[model samples]
Target: YKSIIKTIKDTPLEEFYTSGHRTCQGCESALVMRFLAKAAGQRTIVIGATGCMYVANTTYYSTSWIVPWVHTQLGGSGAAALGTAAALRALMRKGKIKQEPINVIAFCGDLGCADMGLSGVSNAMTYDYNLLIVLYDNESSANTDIQETSMTPYGAQTSFSRPGKQRRIMKKRWKKSVVPMIIAGHRNIRYAATMTPAYPLDSINKIKKALAIGGPTFIHSLDPCPKGWDYDPRFSHELGVLAAETGLWPLYEYTDGEIAYNEPTKSIVEGRMKRKPVKEYLEKQGRFSHFTEEDIEHIQRMVDEMYEEWEIPGVMPIKSL
Candidate 1:
């Protein structure tokens, strides 16, 4: 454990965004934010949106940023990031901030990306702004106590989409696939989907690739919210692994229209790769404990269908899992 800590420390301070701050207990976004900053390096600037991350990590008196950071409105982080990228370019030309190039990074929640900042994020991609946008997808509007968002999984009960005899469904709508939607709008940038704690190495590699690509990039990150998910804080990393293993969140990257899916673990034959059932991932959360076997089966089917549709290579069918 000490060796692991030493390696993490040696990775370089410029790679993470947050250095010192107090985030809420069971909050998973903090981990991803730090990793992103570290990947973007010291010369980067981050444009944050109003969400759990913005409020919990950054307050009036103190902050966790080691780089230039800007907090934008709930629906305008992407646009703000674009403007910052433009300004930085202009500044570099005039030798203002420096003559060297820098990375412009953006961070926001699913609500900000899929709902409020959808247009702004889309436009940023369309304009081909040299920015890296990281959407912290926690499935629920966790800041508001696990409210349903368009990205929330089906058959999962939320205050907005309660499951009962009258309601009968968890979330009536399909998840808004923001990565594909962004691709449809802008063909110039790379896109990827990743999960925290589960695929840290892949996540790190993706961020590095995004920075080196020299164009706009979008990374949809699945960061488990323990408070909302009703799991022990210690289970955050395990939950992330379960999510990928269940095919609920596949570890994949889309670069310039091409898609690459990361295997859930090192190998399938070893049995180490087979993730626990979705029930293990969902059952710990009060939100999903209410689901019956039939409901569970329905959710399982959806997960399987998604894997097939995505044509995720090396992923055994859900039935096998």
Candidate 2:
């Protein structure tokens, strides 16, 4: 049994996801891949679905992954994960290889995981397979020229949802509820959580725990995209931090059939720390550049209702957890 990582000093210097990719500058999703790979260590097999990480990182002669990696269809991450784990188990039993536990992880973006891949992931949750599915949601179809996805945040401008004089606001739909769907529908799921790359330690620890627990697990990560979110590349990490601090995104995990909110978010809920204004979070991004005071207030009210009225913040709206 390995010891739990409590500090940055505790993390090792060796990196498993080395520098070979052609990702955008200040890409938080790239960091998501980096940290998850670091947490999973070298004894891991990664499945990359059709998305930014796969399209931008891999080529015929070159690759970024140090561990074994494979690419699957857009919505096939979960099914591929189940097949991989089952095959590993079968191989050991058949004496083709030594018996040991190996970490199996799959990563997909919002366009793949939330839109096309949703059904495959939902169905895969029922099986008792040892694997982790990470939804690295940048809120749009970024790799395919930034088209809108179901998980795109409200009032944001995308290629498909571009704003014009005829319509000032393009995207009207709220960010789709993802982790909650996993928690509610999959009764036997061992671990489910929401995190952002802004908090590296918290994100890494969550990945570690999800892998430690047996059975299929899911983690939804809100990665800040400089291009998609229309922010300066330098503020990618800060934008992620502001997202959680403003209560627009709440950090929490579901395990052992109970819900627990992480730090700062927990502090905000308990009145120890005040959640920053939504305007502060919005004004930093170019996507919300067209937002008026009324629009900002509208979003604030939605965020307020989520943290104040909902039973599990953004998960369920019941009276109690």
Candidate 3:
């Protein structure tokens, strides 16, 4: 843990994804990409899906990616990355290329990973390719006017699920747990973890560790979107910290069939760190401003259930309402 912390603290002051891109202010996806670029270095190829990152970064007559980047269909990112990795391995084996090993990474949004690109991502995990799939989940289809995706939290207002006189409700279903779905589906995945851009050091360490582990790995990063969530751009990092502290977005990693909770989350579960109220986390964002007392109670109940499921014996007792 100390070595990993040191690696993040000692990261070179180099910007692999330089400024001047058209990403919105406080775009956490862009931050995730920047960290990934720094961790993977120059010997990497980024396979991007048809989402905000691809559209905003590679606009007409310009690009923000300094490393080799390929834009693929929304549902084709995983397949393209798998093919690239396979081709690289083939060329190296046949002595056609004498270059060092190149990392192939696919970056996609929540809609791409959980909705349109689910099959491709599942197949990639099954194939156990030497690649990394980074899912920057901002909760909505931000590129398409903030439509509600499967990963969108319940009671949050989105384009598809808005409050109206006739409906008077937001999203009805719970947010999809893609992390557990992937872990359950793929038995051979080398690494799978949940992270947030707010935790820069942890995020960087996870990316570096994923790249080092030579097998299919998945990093689900909770990227806060100011436009999508209707929050002030400045509160992005604060919201991320709140999300984890409230147990709404727990940080944990699965490696070699072992599950381990990371800091804050570990402390929260152990009762060493007090879990904050879910309302404190939600009240800051406009997306949940319409939530009534009943709505907050429901959300809090869900959080409690999650805590119960993740409780660790011999540590500390789980916090209660």
Candidate 4:
């Protein structure tokens, strides 16, 4: 990593993903793109899946990306990234292109990564190629009118999982713990982490580190959607912060075959800080608007067990030795 962004002041004054796209007013996914661009700088190729980022960022001829960007299929993040990297390596080998480091970042939404593109992503991690895959999870398939995705949290409302008289909560599945899943399923991956724009400096560090790391890496980012979550745009950042504060979304990284929690989450783990109530988090969004007191309590219980009993907190459960 040539430039390590330490604090707000240390951040680059230059903006790579400048303002031009038509993302929602409080779209944290846009922030993820901006941060990724800044961290990687100009010498990067961002492979975008057919999701919100692709649609919103490229409307007609205009685009926000300052560096090279390409459009891939809906479920093609893994294959696209690997192919691009391999092509670059081949070009360098045959003396067709300049032999230099060029960061490759392929991004996908929750559905694209956790569901559609998971197979290709799995295979990519097993390869010796250097690339980074970012899953910008808003929980729902926000671009497709807020449908239920596997990464969507339990009790949250979606177009398909809408609450009705027959079933109060159509979605009974818990949020998939993706980072840990990747860490366990793919031992060859050099780095994996969870980040949010609420902590931009920390996220920048993660992006830089992932690029610097020798092998395939993945990052799952929790994004608060004002439209899908049914909240005012103004509260996006606050909601993102609350997610970490309440342990609903943990900030952590898996590296060197070990896992570690970051910042606020680290404090919660060490007992230096207490995780706020999950109710405080759920009450802010309309997706959980249908959640009853019982439902909220259930989620709270899950979070409690995660910290008090889980061997790796949000990543793994440990009830037995």
Candidate 5:
């Protein structure tokens, strides 16, 4: 692990997604795209869905992407990427193109992934397309004025979940676990993992691994949105770390029917590191500012239940026993 980290750190800086993009300050999705592009290298084709990424990176005629990129519909990027991969395979088989292997990557936001594009993504996984699907989950429909997405946490205020004087009704639904949904639906998926930019090394490693695996790879990255979540822009990384440490977003990898909990998650499972309070995570963002003491306790219970559902004996347990 040290060697791998050293190599990644020592690697010469190469930017596939260059500067001059129109992303806001402390944009986690932008950071995730940059990291993924760096790991994927230049011999890659990116299919971006209609969301913050598409609007920010490709304004009118100008684009920040240096490699081949295509814009797909909000709910069509997954299928589009699969089609691109199939075309490439056909071309290679016909000896029409003699260049090195090119990777097809689909980039989508939480709205596109869990809500609008769920069927497309599930179908792509079912077909076992040789491509990478990256879901940059910011937990809300950020580009659409911070509307509540399917991945939005409960007790969070959004455009769709406005607080009322009579009864403040935040999001009532819990964030959907797309990872388990994919795993349960597609048995042939070569690789899947949850990552965050807070751990750059881990994120890079997972991207590299997914690219190497070559068949229906999925990576769910927690993207902290300062605008949507209403947090200090500079605290993006801090928020990510807090989310992981508090078990609000536990990092783990699933491959070949085996799951491996990573870092603080593993430590928490083994009783080496105590799971931090979920309130520490929720209180930091304005989205959850409306959460009461009872709401906090309910969220804490939900997190505990989530951990238990994802537990794997000797790898990740229900609690620090």
Candidate 6:
């Protein structure tokens, strides 16, 4: 660890992502962007898609990124990155852009990644493009005022699927299982699902691993949006950590050839056995503000089922909802 620290200290953090932007107070996405760029170092190109991050970090006449950056249409970031990588690779072969190796990283939100950018990402992975796609999933489309996305949990209300007497169900549809979906597409690619604030060290490590790989890599991060999650700005990290501990979200990585679970605290099983309830975390967010006792129980049940089905080593099997 001491040698690792010394090596990191020797590397410069600046000259990559410079400060000065107007991102939201509790948005974990910005912090994630900073860490990833830092890990990738100075010779990198970032492809930004339409989302809260794009609006805040690259408003007209101002930009936060210090590296070579390009913004593309929301649905085309993956493709754009693919194009950029192709052009860069071709240029290097022809001695056009200094022939120096460069890293290409794409950034997108939940809606953009799981919903809009799915096909392009799938195609890029299938082609084995040299790029890293970071899905900054804050659950809801926080930048657009919290509309429901496929990643939104059951009993969690968004404007699109708000609970009411007539339609009193939080997303009745299951959250889209994107990790497996991506895995099915490109077995050669490295894939991992992570959460910000809760597992920053693990998160950083995963980013480092993905960068080391030669082909396309996916790192999905569950960033908490305090404004959308309906919590205090400072509680963003706490909420993110609680979600993983409650079995609603698990800290795991898929790479090499199998899946590896990263449960640093053994909190999911232990916490479920002795803690007050999952309601404590749900009650903190306005997304689940309308959930009744029965609704909360339903959510817990789903979490339990997922836990059992996923079979994460060292974690207890979840009971059915």
Who is ahead in TM-score, 4 or 6? Answer: 4
Runs with alpha carbons beyond 4 Å of true place in candidate 6: 1-15, 265-276, 311-321
Write one digit per residue (lDDT tens) for candidate 1, span 110-131: 8988888988887788766588
Instruction: Extract clashing residue pairs from model 2.
Output: none
Distance from true position, residue 116, model 4, in Å? Answer: 0.4
**Clash tally for model 3:** 0
Task: Give the CA lDDT, 0 to 100, for residue 288 in model 1.
Answer: 77
lDDT against the true structure, per candidate, is 0.73, 0.89, 0.86, 0.91, 0.86, 0.75
lDDT, candidate 5, equals 0.86
User: Which lDDT value does model 2 have at 53?
Assistant: 92
lDDT of 4 by residue, 1-321 (tens): 566666789888889899989999999999999999998888899999988999999999999999999999989999999999999999999999999999999999999998999998998889988899999999998998999999889988889898999889898988888888898989888899999998999899999989988589999999999988999999999999999999989899888898889989999998999999999989999999988999999999999999888877877765646
Error of 6 at 259 (Å): 1.1
- Candidate 5, run of 10 with poorest lDDT: 312-321
Q: For each candidate, how many residue pairs have backbone atoms clashing (under 3 Å)?
A: 6, 0, 0, 0, 0, 2
Q: Residue 321's C-alpha lDDT in candidate 3? A: 38
TM-score of each: 0.86, 0.97, 0.94, 0.98, 0.94, 0.88
- For model 2, residues 17-36, the per-residue Cα lDDT tens digits are 88979889999999999998
Return the TM-score for candidate 1, rounded to 2 decimals.
0.86
Worst 10 residues of 4 by lDDT: 312-321
- Candidate 3 regions with alpha-carbon error over 4 angstroms: 1-8, 310-321
- In candidate 1, list every pair of residues with a backbone clash: 15-37, 15-38, 15-39, 16-37, 16-38, 17-37
lDDT of 6 at 150: 86
Q: Per-residue error at 142 for model 3, in Å? A: 0.6
When summed lDDT is taken over every stretch of 10 residues in candidate 3, the lowest stretch is: 312-321
Name the lDDT value of residue 6 in candidate 4. 66
